[model samples]
Target: MALIGIISRELGNLTFLVSLDLGSNKFHGNLPQEMANLHRLKVLDLSFNSFSGEVPSWFGFLHQLQALNLGNNSFTGSIPSSFYNMPKLETLNLKFNSIEGQIPKVIGSLINLRVLNLIGNKLVGFIPTSLSNASRLETLEISYN
Candidate 1:
């Protein structure tokens, strides 16, 4: 258990941040809610860590977000519906977590999405046929329950 302290809120002061990568660290616990203040963020990668707790819904506030990766963590719960509001999103990866539930139908709203990975979770439900609406989608990986 190489875990460190929880994510700090000091990150919120970086209002001009465009890319934030904190993957493969020992950081544990839920992401600070202040992360929602990064309105200019384009790429956010927090993968391969020990982060736990439900994915936050305030992620929708990052309207400029293009790539988001929160994979291989301890996250438990469903994907947030507010994610649909991110019209600029291109890559969304939540693979290898504890998330369980249906893939939201509104996922189709991410028309610019290219890669969607949700593998190795406890999720159970039909693959949303609405995904067909994501015209730009190139790769979709969802396997290993």
Candidate 2:
């Protein structure tokens, strides 16, 4: 059976952690702010969970994050503008959520980004022209807004 419950703030104590995959669980509630302390994280997947609340802006603090997947959750609100700070990010998956707002143009600043999946959200407006600046992007799924 999948795990169910709120993540402990103590999880943030793993300062040397590199990859954390807690996807496909029943975890609900907002992520612990202390998770922002995972500065060395490279891959973080919290998809297919019951987590709600805004995607935390502190995610930007994980500068070493290369792939992040928060798809198929109950999260609401716009993609955090702070995401642009993840300069090394390669894959970002935020599909199948209740998130609203236009995809930020600053997304282009993630020059190393390769996959961006936003297939099922409430995003409106034209795809930002600055996306062309993401020359390394190979897979972009934005269907069913």
User: Which candidate gets the maximum lDDT versus the true structure?
Assistant: 2
lDDT of 1 by residue, 1-145 (tens): 4546778999988999999998888899988989999999999999999899999999999999999999999999999999998999999999999998989998999999999999999889898988999999999999986
TM-score of each: 0.96, 0.98
Query: What's the lDDT for residue 69 in model 2?
Result: 98
lDDT of 2 by residue, 111-131 (tens): 999999999999999999989
**Model 2: pairs clashing at backbone N, Cα or C within 3 Å:** none
Model 2 RMSD vs true structure: 0.7
lDDT of every predicted structure (CA atoms): 0.93, 0.96
Off by over 4 Å in 2: none
